[model samples]
Target: MMSSVINALSVDIEDWFQVGAFESTLDRADWPSFEHRVERNTDAVLAMFDDAGAKGTFFTLAWVAERYPALIRRIVAAGHELASHGYDHQRVFTLSAEAFRADLRKSRRLLEDAGGVAVTGYRAPSFSIDQQTPWAHAVLAEEGYAYSSSVAPVRHDHYGWAGSPRFGWRPVDGSGLLELPVTTARLAGRTLAAGGGGFFRMLPYEFSRWAVRQVNAEGHPAVLYFHPWEIDPGQPRVPNAPLRSKVRHYANLSAMEGKLRRLLRDFRWGRVDALVEGMTA
Candidate 1:
């Protein structure tokens, strides 16, 4: 009944120019060179959802919030949920526990201060939760997050927990934090990207629609997510990025916004925390 009431869609609010995929060539310190940030792009995403009368979660980087307080306020003003996407865009698995703690503490503080709400959800940058960092859930619980959308069930070069369930569930480890893994489907004994991130951008619109349907049919809320850049095709490019990263970042660029618009219209979606609380309550 809870799943029937709403769709659980999320947007990772970051600039097209600020992704970690280009970290080697374009350091975060070099962010000053880019004229565009998440302001107008975030507004565009908000407007897209608004046009569909959709309310969803925004897992914003504290890095973005610190630079654009008014934009953070605007997201709240428009009736979306606020959640953390880390303080910097660093991958969680690579950070030691202490370092990760610092990142979360800082992000939680800034996100709550700017957003004017308790941020109960966290999605790691690049979906970087894996077996190597299963302890991150306990850390999240310690940080007061009630749920996480960090784990990607699909295998990828940078992130993914292969064979992890694709739907939301309370952790068997008793961390008291619900794990809402990004959408995935099993194919040939491996996890395939059912939706979200660059995969969501690259896949055919019909395939995404079908994937969500399959996940929902199994009685879990379809947790779809995307980045601001995925829709902002005109943003500056990182030409020095490795060829593979370049292809992933730039593929199907112009067509993404339309696919997202269709998704908002076709699905019954809502904020991530709202759906979780609604389901468990």
Candidate 2:
């Protein structure tokens, strides 16, 4: 396949149960016994990226950093970028500004200390920055984050900033923050194809390729993200999960890694920081 120059690639370093859709069914406290879950998931991703000679960002939760310090170090050691995915996987909008600030601070410290790199970027637990939660940007700026990939920009049943610009700085109204929304392909005055999470898992390979091409056609970077759990089909299933979420989380799990391999092979990928640096230069 031909290689296309793509802007940035990112990975969310959370396990299967920690996803936002499953939050009601699975609690953070229940993750301790299954803590090692991320090791295999992350390792598969790292190895895949390694084989494709691609380096990208890994946004990890502080809980993961504190529990698996070695994993964080290993990601850095392997020449990938590290960023914070918050302390717990709580949605930023769900927290008060104080709590959100605390989450960012705690996660920032843990990730920086463990990974031995400056954690300048953050992604909220889910894409929790919607119109109602504009304060999230202020708190993020206050916490010293350089940029965020937290707003999905599509109208999902759970989260979205539907009318937000797909790319560019929003001024955060007051916080002086920059929001780097996830990749979305607009259709008929609305966003239909969003490349991330289970959406990445659910879409066909050719469609994803088309979506990225669409984003690139606009002269902006396509910020693609996925959790490690998306590739791990063997993960223990959460009981009483809503049918839609379960399918979104677990559907076509075995094929995802291969699809990702095709993505890496087809695109020129780099860490988000590298893209930022490349832009400024």
Candidate 3:
């Protein structure tokens, strides 16, 4: 691994049931009734980061922050960056401009108060920021977020900002927000999604590794993200999940931790804030 190439590592901190996969089957009000696996699962991730001597950003939900204040503090105490993952894991586009602004404000306050640190970064739930939600950038900047890693350029059914930049760039029509789309790679003249999530699990681990290498070789920082649930195979399953949701959410779960270990060992990992600072400098 090249010592100079430090990629951004992030985790979207939400419980298994809170994931969008169970949106159809699980109701938000019923969240309290389900098992709260985020604390234990996130601690497992913290231990992995410690073993690797790596730091990352945790884009945690305010709902989770209020319920698990100690976990937020624990992330900060371990030298990891903490950022808002919005108030209730709702998609940004799904909310009105006023609603999104409120979400950002409330989440930032909760995270900052709980983590005892400034929250300057955000990642929208499920990367839901798109052209329809251009107002999001200005609102995010106005609310004091310094940067966002919320848009994936790839075309997915639920979310995507197709033709967006794969690396960091400022919006021309949106706002002064510094946008860092998920890391991707060009292969055979077509851009492929490489930044972790379900894609990281669905694809061969070696392919994910190569995609990051490809991005770095092109002199761009690769930003990889994962959910703590992705590493916990034994998590309670969302029974009666739709076929598509089941396939994407449960694919190769048992093998994810090993791939994560390889990722931490094969590349330099750092916080998203560090990358932003470097870019600004």
lDDT of the candidates, in the order given: 0.84, 0.82, 0.90
Q: Between which residue pairs do clashes occur in model 3?
A: none
Best prediction by TM-score: 3
TM per prediction:
0.95, 0.94, 0.97
Candidate 1, pairs of clashing residues = 7-268, 7-269, 7-270
lDDT of 3 by residue, 1-281 (tens): 36479899999999999888888889999999988889999999999999999999999999999999999999999999998899888998889999999888899889989999999999999899898897888888888678999999987787888898888988645555698999888888787788899889889988988898888888888999999999988888877999899888889999999989989999999999999989988
Best candidate according to lDDT: 3
The TM-score measured for candidate 1 stands at 0.95
- What ranking emerges by lDDT with the best candidate at the front? 3, 1, 2
lDDT of candidate 3 vs native? 0.90
List all candidate RMSDs to the true structure.
Answer: 2.0, 1.8, 1.3
Query: How close to the true structure is residue 256 of candidate 3, measured as C-alpha lDDT?
Result: 90
lDDT of 1 by residue, 5-71 (tens): 3668899988876676786778777786777657888898989988999999999999899989899
Give the winner by lDDT: 2 or 3: 3
How many clashes does each candidate structure show, in the order listed? 3, 0, 0
